[model samples]
Target: MGGKVVFKEYDPDQLTFLPYKLEELVPQGHPVRIVSKVVDQVDVKPINRKYKGGGASSFHPRLMLKLLIYGYLTNTYSSRKLEEQAQQNVHFMWLLGMKKPDHNTINRFRSEKLSGVLKQFFSQIVQLLVAEGIVSLKEAVFTDGTKIESAANRYTFVWGKSIKHNKEKIKSQLDELWKYAQTLAGEERLDTSPTTFTEVNAERVKQTIASINAALAEQEDVDPKVKQKLKYAQKHWTENLKKYDQQEKLLGERNSYSKTDPDATFMRMKEDHMLNGQLKPAYNLQISTQEQFILNYSLHQTSTDYQTLPSHIDGYEALYDTLPKAVVADAGYGSDENYCILEQKGIEAYIKYNIFDKEQKEGIKDFSNDSLHYNQQENYLTCPMGQRMQHIGDGQRITTSGYVQIVSRYQAANCHNCPMRGVCHRSAGNRVVEINHSLRKHKQAAKERLNTDQGIKYRKRRPADVEPVFAQLKHNHGFRRFLLKGMSKTEVEIGLLSIAHNLRKWKA
Candidate 1:
């Protein structure tokens, strides 16, 4: 009772000595301060140019940008939450200089004003770090990729395969109608071209349907099935073909795209909530780091990492006006196209191939063509049974991306009574093996570089340098899903995340 009676007097209305400046109140090494300092040095003229001289005044781009970046920095991703924080949080208030921007103003600024300019703004921040000795582009880049869920509906997928299937179905139906028309009106009146339905457009389909209906109109005993089928195709064939044309245009180079957000591709995400490998609408976020700071970032619709390196390097060149001297990436980026491109560009690819780990394992014997004993001078491979495989022909195949792969085919003379015939060569006749000598040469060169002392150092440094940044932003900062829709706006969201990540690293 005596201790309870000694409580200090309290008054809600009483005012005490308060700091006049927010800088004096906030700590020296706060993350908010780091974001503010980094963004303040960026030239917002690119963003400022986004707005023509308007009649109504808007918040300064610098103030809007600072709030947007600091919001992402502190895990406040929603524009509504940012507006609330700008009103209530002292750091946000100080960063905004006491100017309050509502959620609409903030979202508009982020989604529209910073649409194409955020990358430049991000590059400027990286340049400032270069100026202040915080990070470097001269260092070898550690590259990686991860899928981030798009702000698109999951069930609203438009499948390219389905589109092709339906289009072919239309062609088949049209061809069937032509045969029915020829049955009734003879071949003279219904002389349709053989290739009429092979290549079709909306207008061509409409004309063909009209011709089919006209040819059928000449008959008195046309079957009800033919008339009914012609009736439906007349109603929907042209319309369906038009929609398929639009869907194909939206697909670009992807197999599937979301109807809500046409630019987002449906990809198998590791962060699947169903845990059964469900494919979701997501973007491939490619980021490269040096000293654990994100140096460049790009978003791609492609799901695989192999198809993304060339364009990712293009983005890096766009940002810093130079390519990275060396790039270390996982085996996913290893492909014939990627290897040839890196060798062409003279960027020392510390990139591991798809078989990089398996080939290094000892004790197990591999019987693949790549493991064969090759006479380099004679361009022939010796079989395990001491039989010679002659170089027969050079076969060429092209990938979907137009990369031509030349494979040298070799055939063994005979395999009669050889003990290793079934084990080493699985063919009853003479065994034929096709080899892409260029790819093999690339793998050998990469293996040599990866086993070197410097390569060993980067091999150890890669996982530590890049994975932590992704984990920090995704797990700790809660940025796994994008807050905006469409490619341009979604890219701006990733750019902000990368900037926030680098600034937090600098603060640390």
Candidate 2:
């Protein structure tokens, strides 16, 4: 059978639009009302224009503010785009009260009010969530750190101004380019024929070299105080110039250099590069969530995961009244300082250290004699060579419900003649190797978490809780790179994106 014909027009009146209200679609007692309420409380008296004669009119600050915020929540960050959508999209139309706002007006509203407005909105949301009982301060919460990729590339990276010495790399590149330019310039009877390229291109190469060298020379002459800035400028200039030169040189000979975005950086996704491995520049987004709702998110330029924990915790606590009850994190968040901080906070934290090797240094495990085991409080340890270590003077000791640490030193004389010297002693001869009293806290926690039913539930729930949110933003929402520069702006961008994600989730 043949296909049936179908036709459609862009007429609005002929369509029967469904009643899909944004306000009605959202959950009961959503923070949108709180947003409206808080915005109502902001004073617009100062913004009102006053004539010399008498009273004056005031622009609707609240309406414009609401539109801008709703725009952010919907991921319509571009002011022009927001304005276009406001006239077209039903939700945006309703939010903006069917008024056609110019793109410039929208931009001014966002740029002028975003800083203060976002903070106010965030505080109100926190307060509303607290009131709604979505957050519980009494339960244990798990925490993890993830690196946020920055909008800027590392090549744009500027460092502290230092002019101690010259680098041979720059010298080498300059020398090579100069030689190549000289060679290109000297070419006579340049081949018009593609097959017979006249005497290797020297003059072109020479010009290129001269250009690069000039940039280098300028950098070298810059004042020591301003050398860093000069270096950065030269680096960027030379790189861009080289790209142009290479493209022009290869013209039809090769494909044009395809770096359309200079802000992008190559991010390594895996430790080892396999055949099918992928690499791309992406923002490392860090998010903190509660009750399946994202509380905070931040973007950073960190390549490592170690440094994001403390600051994130601080940010969360500052934004919200209380911290999550029990902080659960992966091994990346595990550090001596973090452990100390968690303990100090009186929070039950479960951060796993990535230490898998559990081999005993010596036969110290066998040294737990009847006497040693009986008096567990004393500061003593067993040596690998079946010898007991006793503390000489006042030494520090730590104890937990699971295990006690008895740190002590072995006699150098006794360790010297031990038959199992290689395993027990790492030094040249009889030397005491101070051993930490082994505590089974980590082992016990791991075992219980993997075995117990509650632990199993938490483990299962964790990945589903946070991982999908990130996947949605990155995959569905086209939020891979940032639109702003610098850490503070990046943080704000992240916050907006997070707000957008939550709003979408709520809408869905």
Mind giving the per-residue lDDT tens digits that candidate 2 earns over 1-508? Answer: 8799778756766655685666665456554553445457655443332213345632366677666556666556677887898788766665555677788876655444454336445545545555667655446554543433445543332111111012223444444443433354332322222222222233433444345345445333434533453345344545544544454443322121113323333354532236455444434456666555676655434434545666666766776657776666566665545555566676655555554112212322433321132225765555555465665543455422122345445443467557777654466755454443332344335434544676656656666776777666655665555655544455556655665555455445
- In lDDT terms, which candidate is top? 1
Model 2 RMSD vs true structure: 14.3
Q: What local distance difference test score does each model get?
A: 0.87, 0.51
Q: Which stretches of candidate 1 lie over 4 Å from their true place?
A: 1-5, 16-23, 363-366
Q: After superposition, how far is residue 227 of candidate 2 from its true place, in Å?
A: 22
Cα lDDT tens digits for candidate 1, 191-292: 456734667789988888887777778688988988888889889989999999999999988899999889999999888779999889999999999888
Runs off by more than 4 Å, candidate 2: 1-65, 72-75, 101-112, 159-284, 298-303, 356-380, 389-456
